[model samples]
Target chain A: MIRRLLLFSLLGACSLPAQFGLFLVQNGQDVASSDQTYGFGTKPVGAVVNLEFHLRNSGADAILTDLHLSSTDFQFIPSAPSLPQAVAAGTALDLMVQFRPGKAGAATADLIANGVKLGTFNGIGLASVTVSMGDGSPVPSPLEFGSVKRGESSARTIRISNGENSAVLVNVGTRDKTFQVKPGTSPIPIAAGETATIEIDFVPAADGPQQSALLIDQLVFPLVGTGLEPPFPPPTIDLDRADLASAQQGKLTVRLASPSQATGTGEVDMDIQPSDASANLDSGIQFLSTGTRTATFNVNQGDTVAHFGSDISATFQTGTTAGNIVFTVKLGYFTTTKTLRIAPAVVGLDSSKAQRTSAGLDLLLSAFDNTRSATSMTFTFFDQSGTKLPPGAITVDASAALGQFFTSSDLGGAFSLHAFFPVNGNPGQVDSVEVQIVNSAGTAQTARLPFTTP
Target chain B: MNRAAVFLLCVAPAVAASNFSSPLVGLTGDAQGKLHLVHGVAGSFVVRGAIAGQALDWAFAASGGLLKTADELRVLDAQGNVIGRRTASESQVLLNPRYAFFPETGELWPASAHRDRALLIQSAAVGGRVIALGPADQREIVLAACRGDHLWLLTFDITSGALKHESAPGGTIGEQACQAAHRAALLVLEDRVLLANAHEIVIQTSTGQERRLPIPRNHGTRIHRAGEDTVEIEMSGAPSFVLRFNSEGERLYELPAAEARP
Candidate 1:
């Protein structure tokens, strides 16, 4: 075993000269050791530093093959000779090595040939500018502003510091119109190791998600903000008049206007609450195209003010009694009540005394209510055959051949409204007359009178 | 004997609530012929009596159309009891019936002697169910039938029961893609037939012109007459919607199911 080991050691000594013939040279000087490291210290990020290395063959034989790079940060120049290259004895070949770091960090790689390491190259990447918040914390890559309402502004401060020894000219701007930088100037000069504060304001013009980037020289910091819609104000509803007659129809209008400066949209709920269960209230809203009796409506966006008009009609059962009925209109959280007076049926025609004039038959009417007020009294005349006379054939007079029958005091429910109606047909042909007395509340009562010409 | 009670039988109360899983069959009047009753399917049928009262359950399995004799509608129950009375002629009786339909071949048999003779068209043999039976005009009867996944619109002469017109049998009942057979319903209007599923409504006029109207999809849908020219659609599920449309398929109004109920 000892003799065999001495024989293998002598064989290795014979091959050492052939293996030691390959040498790496930098800048025309041969490197004494293959393990030596070369460093290009603290180069700016994205900066490429080029270096040349020479591979010289000092032995009489042996060629280099399978030459390739292992590091992504290191790239070989295309002008360099192809791999599997051969160098004659006492001859050299040149190759270029480039170090381009993508970010601020240390990069290291080894140059190898045929499974043997040749040399190590090291590099340190330096950032040109460091951006941070106003309070000195590192500025988040995406400066998020979260949600901001439309037509409202939100602001944040960005501190840009020059990390390089030399001063940097940073032209601060935004990629979208939604963001704006205060001071309205470009190319702000930041001293080395010194920071400059720039206020960034985000004012969204529309509702939805918004995105932009803050451009500081060649470095871009993303600006993200989401524009939200503002809360809508409740709708306002109003009635044209509070009090209405029982048989009269009235109008109720609903209006919606945004409290914010921007236009908005929403929906309004409208309904009627009647005070009396016996009162049948009929209401409807006139839509843009057709009228709907529904109590709900929608207001679309971009509508500055939306108006809806509703027609309300009330009806009461037949009775001689008078009372006030309250109708409430609710829109959103607001409510308004209107009181309507249902006038009593206090007027009646007297049938016993009837006189026939040369033109027509005459009839007398009287009011019975002492508390209910009215404005006018209308008398409808019908012939004895129960056929109503046309308006052109009959005439009513409160002061003809008598004092004022329906005076202001009578209208105020202080006295009875004594009125008379004359038929315009021939008295000889008119046998009897039917008179209908109608009050201002549209309540009416009728009586038939026997007619005799005197 | 009371004419007012008979008139009330023809005009029943609207369905305040419905369960789409169970079939609902409405009849014209009670056993005494006092008022109309809306019958819904339950373990025992729910009968809504008197047009405005609470729904009560009835045990008998009763279904049939009202028979018209001169000016009165006489509907008999399965036991030959006079349960329905209304003022309607032979033509008017076809417009809207209290019962679901005249089931000629199903287990439900008509008790009235005049019902079988007055039927304009017999039920189809292939498990066909009558969705609606109404008059297209004074002389013709329009029938809507559902057999499997298809809906058929058939018009027949009122007197002779001769088939006048028939629509092509297919997915013509507004069947949506991948929709099951149990989700569709049919409505017979004055001049058209409405075939509706969860997704759409297909309106086929008496003259064979077809129109399609899209609606929101739901689990189950039911279509019934709201007025002479209006039809009400009820969608069943959480947060259901009730939609009203005219005969021309124009949307009149839409309300949430909760809001639409009395």
Candidate 2:
């Protein structure tokens, strides 16, 4: 009985319970055994840091279990294996830990296994600031302000937002004198989670594209702007003469004078309009030989005026119809008009009954007075080939000589008058004569007299 | 006297008495008629003789009533500088042979007995023979050439020798028309250049604008600027007629046609 008791005591001593102890192995070394803490260094705010914690069971018989994180900032991804995991003695188990601090401060968490602290994880979050446009859009580098006219200014506002937990001091400026910042002071204070407004102004002194930059402390927001000359005012057009008689020529003028001190450029359009639909006005006017009714003329800087005109020959064909025709001249917003009048009295010559005298030729001319009395008659001679002869070749003898070869009368009715042209040369060689007769109404008529010399 | 001298003496009297009629050869002289031409001994031909000096060797035929010679025409300036030369054909009649105007240069070149090289004014743009040349303005020269159906007017800067403008008046002037243009006379006014032909009168302004004024009754062959605002045009037909016009192309007066004896 004593021998049996001794064997049982030896077995009981050999079969004692295994002690369970946990440690954290980092970089293949026992960090929790040497110290109790693991540092993750400082990181920017809103940044995530990954760390690996190796939990080892240093005891011989017990398994690792009940692994957890004390702080919400420190989390185990995929959760440390189920509680009571069989981690043999002198074996290791891997736990992935993530440190994501929401603010700019130190974050600490305890790594526990089997209700015992394994190690402590410490991380620090940094602070930062960001710049954006006033409209809440991110600031673009080298902002462009397309084209701008001379003496014109443009402005843009920017917001400096402090994204950190602490307030930040911001300074805004530009290297160019053409670019200016509103409030004109540096070190603008912006609270955490708040923004400070800064305005950038680009005033150009000359026309063209310009550039500058906005300095927000160490950060640079490139700025650009263009300067252009102000637009020119429309040109003014005028007619030289306000009234023109039928068969008379007149001139039209286009002047480019702007009261705004701007130089005029581009082309001016001119149009002709007649009061009577039956009266054709364009046919009487000629411009650049490219048709008459409408024309486009150029106006350059320093050049103030251009002139154009047309003869009123077509108005004469309006024949005894007294009316007005208006010429509309337009240059940009400026317009002008001129009036023309056609009268009704007609006076002409009859050349069929031309008689040849011994010394010269006698021409019988008939004058008709429709609205007024016929007053005068004038005569001219041309060869069959339309050449002007010498003055000594012919002599004119009229009853009432108004001038050298004109006869003056006040015949109210249609009357036939005699004008003698004494040819110094042979009358047999006579070709043709032209007669122009005028009435008291300032109306004139012309007729060509073809003669057969006998 | 010798036989030749006696023959010359016998013809001299008749030559001095012969009266030159229409289409007469124009004589060159100063306003005082100091260097006028006297009749030769023979009536069939006339020699260039000064009024109070020895006679010249140049003689022209008197039968055609126009200047005709087998030699070329040489035009000289007042200082006796040669200006132009032209070869005269048998069919060509020299009108106003004593004085001719180089309308291209607006220079009055006088005819001389001397021979010189001719200055031919031309333009490739026209592509045809130059029918007329005149001044478009005081500083510009105009050349009018006629081809098959084209009438081209080319203006050149006189000082720079550069072509400033070119325009082709749309119309087909046939070969007959070209001949008529050759016989036409040119007159340059202050603002217009008048070219009078046998068929029509073409007036071109200093601004390169052209207008063809038709003579419905008769054909014009000569033109002369009578006054600042007047142009005298002469017809080509038997009954001599003269038409006067103002600068604006208005007919002022027309003289009755008369028989011209040649």
Report per-prediction Cα RMSD to one decimal.
18.4, 23.0
Scoring each candidate complex against the real one, what DockQ results?
A: 0.02, 0.02
Query: Per-candidate TM vs. native?
Result: 0.35, 0.32
TM-score (0 to 1) of chain B, per candidate?
0.48, 0.41
What value of lDDT does candidate 1 attain over all alpha carbons? Answer: 0.47
lDDT for A199 in candidate 1 is 94
TM-score of chain B of 1: 0.48
Once superposed on the true structure, which residue ranges of model 1 sit more than 4 Å away at CA? A1-127, A134-147, A167-196, A202-228, A238-244, A247-251, A258-294, A306-443, A446-454, B1-262
lDDT digits (tens) for residues A1-454 of candidate 2 = 6875555444434432333333455577755545768777766667787877666556554444466889887788767577545555676677778887665557898877656776788887544567788898988767877776655678888877788777655656898878889979876777888878888888877667778788876567888888876654454445545544332333445555653333333333333333334332222332321223355554434445643323211111111222554455555455655454444445432122455567666654433333333344445565667764433122222223322111122111223444455555566555666665565556454545666433
- Backbone collision count in every prediction? 0, 32
Give a tens-digit lDDT track for model 1, residues A1-454. Answer: 8985665455433332334233445667865554457675656667899877766656654455545566867776755467444555676667778888655557887777656666677886655777788898877878988899777889999888777676656668999779999867987877778888889999988888788999875567888888976654555555556643322224445454564344532333323332333322222111111222234434445543343322222111111124554444444444545444544544432113356666444442222332233333333334557664444123233222112221312111212222233323354444454443334445444444556554
Recovery fraction of native interface contacts for candidate 2? 0.00
Report the C-alpha displacement of residue A192, candidate 2, in angstroms. 8.5
Candidate 2 docking class: incorrect
Q: After superposition, how far is residue B156 of candidate 1 from its true place, in Å?
A: 28
Candidate 2 chain A weakest ten by summed lDDT: A312-321
